[model samples]
Target: MAAFLEAVPARIRTLGAYQPGKSIRQAEQESGVSCIKLASNENPYGPSPLAVAAMQRELAGVNFYPDQDSLDLRAALATYAGVQPEQVLPTAGSSDLILLLLRLLLGPGSNAVGGDLSFFLYRIMTKSVGGTLKQVPMVNHAYDLDAIAAAIDHNTRVVLLANPNNPTGTLFTADEFERFLDKVPARVVVALDEAYSDYAEEFAVRRNVVWSRAFDYVRQGRNVLVLRTFSKAHGLAAVRCGWGAGPAELIGMLAKLRTLFSVSSVAQAAALAALGDLEHIHKSAIANAEGEAALSHALAEAGYPGVPTWGNFIFVETGEPALEVAAKLEKQGVIVRPMKAWGAPTAIRVSIGTSAQNELFLTAFRKVMPAH
Candidate 1:
């Protein structure tokens, strides 16, 4: 073990592995019962029929290598995002793009700024490249944009942000984001993770939250990278496809650093098909909005009110040890994510599931949680 440690970089040795949420099979194995998984913020409804068909058609061509540049898919995505094809870079997923950005921009002396409780990957990715992650404390369970801007300095290479931030599911508006960007130096690249942007847009009409202008920033020649994924509303998580839009020059740099043929043929095909299926996307978003409302209301009535979420998940303060609550719910055939890893020991993040799944979770929660 000492030899192995010596072989690895000191920075790499200090990092811990990412802990993903519990799977349905794992939950069932632990609980000895069938379980509904609401731990990962996946779309309850599955992928579009068109996307599935596209994957099926590409199966025979798996013997051949995928397009190295992902040209066709990039064109489709560019059109969808209202940007030039050169401005977009597709990858295996948004996480892949994050690593690529860090590899390209970070080094020993540089650092990245982000909310303390935002996406966990920001810290891991930064540290992996021997860079510091300056985490600014959040305000009211949301990103403190001003504090984050203040944290940036000469050595700051990146500013990482997640819309509908993970764990908390809170966001800042477009005006706020623009003001924050004004304070950022031109050399610092702002990597905006918009994995949950679709859901945020769906809820925006009712909630009055202005969606981000990251893409607009790209068009205006800002050093901003807008990362998005098909894993959520598109229901293409298994396909592992996502894209980043930025200035053409920045996109070129990321493309050069991207692993060769990182996105498989199956993933590219499914993502291409999913891009055109706006109806399915819209339906999924509407269903998620409905589910969020229902679940939030139910939890509130049960004396565990959840934070207003723009993502397809609700962050609830359980007023109990979150891991204990999660374990009890798992035993009752419901699986949720405890926020202990994110430093909120009394909170759990519950993905908004189908109405029936939500009902099952509520029933299980009632059985496990003591009444107020």
Candidate 2:
């Protein structure tokens, strides 16, 4: 009989599964106390009221399949991006888009490039396609675009760039990107995953340049695709819908690869409705900004300085081992993410929660860290 481990591909067996943040249910079950979870960078404020109503309305047609091509959502996303619907492609989420793009762009002999301390799913997705993953190390805990561009070779098919990058939450500037774009060839695809773009702060100094305009490069016919999710600012994480905005030709090819009716009717309906409630998103941003500032300040006062963040999560260096700190905190009714899988055993990622949640987390963190 064939052994189960032997049946799996070498790369698949070698790759670690994606480690999600600890669930609140799991924590409460393990601990005697009710837990406040600040692990997953989820919106502590729930989904838009309009989106909830839309989702409830969709329950009436639960038996019907979603539009295979997500036409309505595409049109909505296109309007937001100032592009044609043909240039937009919706997926189950940004992760789904990443998975689909990995399949479409990679094969046995190609390579994908991204940062070492980035959304690690890109590495797994690239490896699953039998492609080499070139993880360029960050400079000063931020993306070194120059190093990333220099890492690309002839066989490099895709470059995964996360704006306001995950874990570390560092964002590259428009001028920095413009310079980097000059080095990249038009043939190679650059995927800009902007899932955390909702939490990005607008600097009046820049006057309008906040999020990465990688999608605009796509509109200009560059080989770029900007990925966004309803999961973040729209607070529709459970709905599981995201999109890729790119050149029409690439989007057309990607559409051929999209799973038919993979997006649920509820997700589609909710995402469409979420787009209209711009004020909810603004409120979310304000709350997130306040939470992040408070948490960072608190962590600094405890002598555990955090990385400079543009996203809602704060990655702080724990004086002790990260997993150990997290375990202790979990027992004390607070939950944060341990970053051992990302190769940083000294860091714990704490998401910006609601005002009360943040206070609870801070209280628990101080209580546990001192005693641990």
lDDT of all the models against the reference? 0.91, 0.85
Across residues 201-299, which tens digit of lDDT does each residue of candidate 2 receive? 432122355456665786688888899999988999878999989989888888888888878989989999998899998889878877777888888
Per-residue lDDT of candidate 1, residues 242-351 (tens digit): 99999899889989998899999999999999988989999999999999989999999998889989999999989899999999999999999998887789889999
**Model 1, position 181: C-alpha lDDT score:** 90
The CA lDDT at 306 in model 1 is 93
Best candidate, lDDT = 1
Off by over 4 Å in 2: 1-7, 201-209
Please count the clashing residue pairs in each candidate, in the order shown. Answer: 0, 0
TM-score of each: 0.98, 0.95
- Predictions: Cα RMSD each: 1.1, 2.0
C-alpha lDDT of candidate 1 relative to the true structure = 0.91
